[model samples]
Target chain A: MVNTSGNVLVVDDDKLICNLLQDVLMRNNVSTMTALNGEEALSIINSSHSIDMVLTDVNMPGMTGLTLMQRIKGISPDLPVVVMTGFGTEQIAVKALLAGAYNFCRKPFDINEITTIVKKGLDLRRNSMREKEVIPFLKVQLHFEIPSDIGFVRSIVNHIQRECGRLGFPEDVFLMRVKLALDEALANAIKHGNKNDFSKAVGIKAEISTKKITIEITDQGSGFDISRVPDPLDPKNLLVEGGRGLLLMGLYMDSLEFNENGTKVKMTKNAQS
Target chain B: MEITTRENVEISIVALNGELDNESAELLRENVEQLINEGKVNIILNFENLSYSNSAGLRELIALYKLANSKGGDLKLCCLQAQIEDLFSFTNLKKIFSIYQDENEAIASF
Candidate 1:
């Protein structure tokens, strides 16, 4: 094991696995921080600046690995992410690789193999960051209005996911996160904003670039204050099933803010470098 | 996906094949839970013919492992394909489940 000054973020729902990985990486002299799930991982990434690489598991209780990857890319597109999977679902792995993962390894991995991959990913990140001329690309814009039909929201998200796949975006996490966020935002627009009106339209705009992707969803209905909504983690709401969607949006999106009208939300995701 | 169950003494072996995705994961979970509830604790998952599995399928497996462990019984895997093995390796799930080279070895362990 060779000592490297780079820091690593290991995100997984399983505590035992987190401990095992911490031991392995620490023994190799790599600094490590662990998060139990994607939401926590995002907070850690946002608050900490010294991280070199992110190693995350694909599946978790609330936010999936693909979703986490998107958030990470939004914050630091140049940072390298390595994904881990326990099931031989090639589609998901292919998705991850496409999303911007430097590399992926299966579970029950050999210690030597993981160490080598981690070292390589860190090296790539370091080299890329050192190059100062990497210009961010133009932001792509996509706008759609919420249809009067309630069932159409799912189709819209599915269509976006398919379109993202066709575009061959460098990271699959972006697609997944966008899809999830789109689903939540659209649902909120239709159900809450439009009050399930089949006639009202919700406007959507997406700005894409090499460095980040920002999307805004606007509803025709009256707007509400985002801050007034109680936190889902409140003690009395612990058993509730519905309040977590907003929390998820806040966690996954780099920034979730509302326009003055309160009917519009502008969310941004930084592109993976 | 297809599941074929065979019982020898008190040990049960569930042979699985085909793709296990969100659509098929529930069936697998229910079948495993039913067996566990029936007091068939020692189990072998014969993966000699399994082709693929997704995150949903992996969740089901984890649930089954937790159930079996709670009952002091173990769930063992046998004859995993290379790609499937890689998935296990990446997720570190291969650490949680006991794997064997063949069904005979897995069944005999109990």
Candidate 2:
């Protein structure tokens, strides 16, 4: 149940369609601002103080929805944009998803379905934002330069486990998800980032709370673009022998953040999980 | 990670404990290759004792699976912990490999 004062920008060329959705959204306790085209949508977005989300039609006359989506992402990378298209135009929906739209809904949408999607999208955005805040019970900082030695990962894991134990986290969790995610992150820093150069060191900053934990790993090497990291799940990459560590970290951890240069990475884990 | 092997008739049951990671993956690779070179090819990896595992270890499993098959042998795996099962569920390895609930079932398959 969305009981808000949250604003959604509805973009579609037809006035009647816009009113219908605005009515549907308002009846569900969501407020809306409508635009007849993508250009108008952009203008409204620029003027508004805050828009929680955008629900747009893919086939708008001027400045198509996909292009508008790209422009919105440029300004607000994490703003949820629901790409709506007619029933038969699923190809555009797929394209929109690939181009980083939050989600897609088909035209002739039901009020129930649209509201549910909107609520879920807002929840996801809020949860990710919450993960960024480190309300720490305790904080630990460490630095290490892993040499070209066997079982170096084990040594690092042991050190972290010691810190986790002192912080009152459970051993089972330390051995399970924590160990796996830390191993992958450290391996990336050592092998890929620093090329296992004994002279290079990785910096680590960790915040631990009774409920959650966040770890940041920074390396000395030149970083690559985070966007170009391929999806290991893609058909071509799935069967490859290695390169699945980062993907595994994503699965085992709550959220991941990387600096623009990708040399630094942050991972958060819910200790209670 | 520690790799120790025991023979149950024609099948070699390899027990893996501790973490299976980049460094340990090499040890498992060498251990399996040695068994294959000795013409003892049918193997069942008992993961009941795995404390940790990752993609590097996964890569070794894939390579050994392929190599064993090329020589008319098969690698059967069993006793997956909840975490390992979760991992397999994502990587398509769950569908690709022959997984059993227990060492008895895995060894019985041979």
| Candidate 2 docking quality: incorrect, acceptable, medium or high | acceptable
Candidate 1 global Cα RMSD: 20.3
Displacement of residue B50 (Cα, Å) in model 1 is 18
Candidate 1 similarity to native, TM-score: 0.38
lDDT of 1 by residue, A1-273 (tens): 374668999999999888898899998888899999999999998998988999999988899999899889999887889998886766788999999888888887788889999988877777766653343433346667667555676566666555454344445566435555666677678778888787888887776555566778888888887778767556564423344446657755778888886798988776552
Task: Evaluate residue A224 in candidate 1 and report its C-alpha lDDT on the 0 to 100 scale.
Answer: 81
DockQ of each: 0.02, 0.35
Predicted complex 1: CAPRI docking category? incorrect
Off by over 4 Å in 1: A1-138, A162-168, B1-110
- How displaced is residue A9 in candidate 1, in Å? 42
Residue A111, candidate 2: alpha-carbon lDDT: 72
Q: What is the lDDT for A72 in model 1?
A: 90
Name every residue pair that clashes in candidate 2.
none
Candidate 2 lDDT tens digits, A1-273? 654457889999999989999998888787789999988889988888578899998887778999999999988887899999998998999999999998998878877789889888877766755664543445665566555333577787788778777665667776777788888888888788888887887776666655666788888888877678877777776556777888888877888988989888999888777
The candidate scoring highest on TM-score is: 2
